[model samples]
Target chain A: MNNPGMTEVLFSLILVAIAIAISRFWKINVEKDIAIGSVRSFVQLVAVGYALNFIFDLESVWLILVTLLVMALVGAQAASSRVTKIKSPFVLILFSILFGSFVTIGIMAFLNIITFEARYIIPLGGMIIGNSMNASALSMNRITSDISSNRLTVETALSLGKSWRESSALYFRDAVTTGMISILNSMKTVGLVALPGAMTGMILAGADPLDAVLLQIIVMYMILMAVAVTSVVVVELTVRQLFTVHHQLK
Target chain B: MGSPSLVVSHVSKIVDDKKILEDISYTFYPKNIYTILGPSGSGKSSLLRLLNRLDESSSGEIIFDGQTIDSYVVCELRKKIGYLFQTPYLFEKTVKDNFLFADNTVSNSQMLELLAQVHLSQKMLESSVEKLSVGEKQRVAFARMLLTKPKILLLDEPTSALDPSITEAFEQFIQKITIKENLTTIIVTHSPEQAMRFDQTGILIADGKIAESSDIKSLLENPQSDAGKRYKARELS
Candidate 1:
């Protein structure tokens, strides 16, 4: 029999080689980061493979809860690092992801469209958490930069008897608009330019073509709600800290 | 009715283990243009910011119009005191939008009149702020600041980045606005010649403290100390 796994490994190696060559030609210092990230990804995926096998077998609700808790903590850490100067970024991340992902997951589960089993729960949770993390990071970074750069304008608004929220409305609008654009664009091109991961995974798992398409539709809808809600809410909360109690931007 | 236009009492600021200002006490009356003349890093800008409460004083108090600055809301205080930076910080929008900012109250006629006062035409309003020359941007910024109808104006080297002709135009505009509006103005500048133009009262700061406070021409003519002599040399040079 042909070693198909060997083909996958060889393909990955070639991709790495091409990445290195491009980096060298462009004088990019991403070589060390790429090497370390690849190694870490390998180790993490292997470890998670074993852990997930055990988790799937147990079929306990508590186990699923712990897994989601771990995901939240990791997502919070990632989001916080991107918007560093603000204190309590973890709180904003936690609130955003928990509200966004859980709401999406809850609605889908309640509809009985996707099974409440480990097989569906873990993957869906991962997708929701990952997308929400990206949205939160983008919105937070944009809002922070916006507030700092448009400081004079913000102060001008404040002087005009506007509240902090009113003063920062323009920035809040810009940041959330920027964060949602990617999701919106992907939505615009869905099923035309790209077959997203959920759809591809469902298809490879021997699911019917129509069934896979339906699941992908649900997942896309959930992602839209999660990304939009998470980005807007997180930015609103995080920007409150940029101002003093006296309504002044420090 | 008896309240002074602005009052700063015993204000001090310490940052990074360095004292920027210490026990600064002063009263500024209405309809007068005051110039803060100081060598670089002498905390003149810090003191000016203290009037509007932009920079917090570590100790002591600032009172404006018989009320403690701490008592007035920060936003309200800032609205009453307009601040203009050395470099024109125009937004990435049309000149008209930059003037209006988030303020919907400023009407088209008011903006046009303001532009005309600064020698800019209505045709320039629709142009992007980034496309304007530095002097034009400064004029736009000044017009924008005045739109709020601030009772006091704080200008930090308004013409520092301008060419001689533009600086002369800016100075003339300054004279017109201060006289017309009867606005209490505090200007921070390094040039003695420029300071003499609108400086009805002068305060010289050196080594993080006020070295002299007198009439602008008097301060220029009679050198009081080594610091004053240094400023005089700059003027002569």
Candidate 2:
């Protein structure tokens, strides 16, 4: 069978309709979410498709960089919104995601791991940016909540003349650990637990199993590095938000 | 009174346009155990917090050791004027970790000595703080704060966590440590009994101001101002 065209994709939406109908029958309350999500994803993916096609055809480094920068800005905005407490965290989140994506992808290109083609860079950059986004948000959330709750511990350390960094060290460590825990768990139980998304997708799309496996390995490592860098950046910025230069909790 | 160690000059703390502490001034002497007595919400804790620069005053100055507190580097100042919270928090892990956290250079003998000052056993060094009783945790926190050899100690209702017997002993230990180390000790307590037990200077804080400053017995038994007299009535009952 041929890969589903937009018409086939539209026909496939019957599955979502069926799910929505079942939710209605059971009064599961998530029918609104499912319906909105289906519509939003359709619109978003369609826009991304057009944008990527245009960027790829141009094949200009400036054009690709602009697109990646835009994506990083959006990713950062999304991640910062998820972090509940912090005064105006957009700049921090943007810098974290941008640094994580560009540095990793830039290294790969410089090392001749992947050519600087829009085809390769855009999708891979998107993956890195996406993973880093979640890690940054989750980590920031964890550390902020931890510090707010453990005010006495932090203030006690500060009262002992500990520097701000030294005072929040415990919370900082826990946040970074939490941010990277998902990737670490995946690394630990990847092939044994279940086939990962990338490998499965490649196999479904008729690629060689060994080739898919090799690509999956690279993808996992890239994600690991991106997540690690993002986690550090988020925690570094976040802990600063929680304490003043005078070593007092804010 | 011992030599003057800290001078609070016209200090007032206003938060949200309300007076937390209003035009309060006091001089603290080294080796003197000063007990700050006040009703709940009388800004007794607020006054102690201002001494260590934990919270800033809306208007006024605190002179620690003849210099304005703001002139000193904050971390260094805090080290010298250690503030032990009402409910002490120990860093998780061994009691040794708590001491080392305060001063990494503290030797085993020093740790034992410091713990002994707080009436803790030397065997408590390896004991995890999580496993310790609330009273034990407070003692350990007090010992840890002392590791840096602070010149002043701010205890915020310190004996609140301890049993009655432990509290009396701890109070005695505090009196001993204050004289032996010549530390400027400020304790904010709800108990008039504790204030009398310390027997240094008693300052009655009423409505964000010092209503009376006298010996604990006189302040409690023969209070001066109307506010002081009312506080005396409540305490006696």
Candidate 3:
């Protein structure tokens, strides 16, 4: 079977044209960003393509470790950008993504559900870290806005002899719950309503349907675990810094 | 066994190179109403916030009871000194929730009785506080303050947003709460008439300084400083 390279290029051009038309109709200041992001995405994907080709050939444990570290660092940087008020936010993001991805990957490897190999490790680690990064960013942003906007409410509670944790409990709960919504929505729509990329890719590569389904289930469970642990831990740690030792909002 | 309710020793506050309050010293005793009369931007609000350590002074000490203000935990200090804003910023909750802010465990009957003390209807409790009139909200704020049973009440133009009749009612409510609760009250108001209604001891602040500190009648009747004379003429006019 022949790959339709020209058809793919024509489809990409049509999508770009549509995006530009929509932006103009909506009067959105998105032209420059869209152009820049498109170029950057192409460059990034080409670089990743070459890197993955080489990475697949190496088959070394150290190379895999290095690739995972780079991914985690990029995830941390992305998460930190969403929360500028928080000093040392990179530390929180680093720990969250690292711990979340490692734990998920470790459990799968230990269970022998997925062989400890480059193809599985790289893609699985990337998915876990990416989802955890997003969850942490969402939780932190919500928590920061909630604390600053409702300073009086928190202070009022604190004055009434409520502990810092007790005072900001509602805000913390709201942030975590907000972050969890995406995961919950995906869970609701998975398998029946939509086929995820991993499952579809495995099926396309001539893998058995049952094996592909099992892998998808494991990946979904790992994503949920990663998001939950990262969001809760990061939010709890960062919230403590918002209050002073005197129980005043900082 | 306790010292005066509040004592400020040579307190000075500077923000962004401008002096808001400079070298202010005074003592407030328990069960007395002390009114700080000043024009807009005269640091009247800043002075009130200082007492509760909401706004820190650049120098000098604020001693509440026997301990220095800095010695007490800010949250604990704020609990003891209830600070009410010019505009009643009621939460997005029922009137009952507003009072329950200080202590949620209080019985509904106790809250209703307290509301009655402030001349508020019991029906107001179940309604949304956002829907209340300015006067009604001010009264609810007073009721809310009473829940904490604060040792001192610092009011920054509590009736500023009300109409004439509502202002008069608010004044009466202040009088009732001060006497009934035995609260040491420091009220900051621009209205000389309201200041005179509250207490005799009045401190007039002008150009970020205390121009006069005396009885309300003395300050109003026998103006001494140029600022005081000008203030008196304006009030009379």
- Identify the candidate with maximal lDDT: 2
Tens-digit lDDT string for candidate 3 (B141-186):
7678768778899888888877787677767777767777777889
Please identify which of the two predictions, 1 or 3, would achieve the higher TM-score against the true structure: 1
The 10-residue segment of model 1 chain B with minimum total lDDT is: B228-237
Model 2 segments beyond 4 Å from truth? B1-3, B235-237
DockQ result, candidate 2: 0.78
DockQ for every prediction shown = 0.27, 0.78, 0.24
lDDT per residue (tens digit) for residues A204-244 in model 3: 78889889998898889989988888888888878987876
Interface RMSD in angstroms for candidate 3: 3.3
TM-score of chain A of each: 0.86, 0.94, 0.85
Measured with C-alpha atoms, the lDDT of residue B68 in candidate 3 is 94
Question: What overall lDDT, based on C-alpha atoms, would model 1 receive against the true structure?
Answer: 0.81
Error of 1 at A240 (Å): 2.8
**Which candidate leads in DockQ?**
2
- Residue B37 of model 1 has an lDDT of 90
What does the i-RMS of model 1 come to? 3.2
Rank list by lDDT: 2, 3, 1
Which sequence of candidate numbers ranks them by TM-score, best first?
2, 1, 3
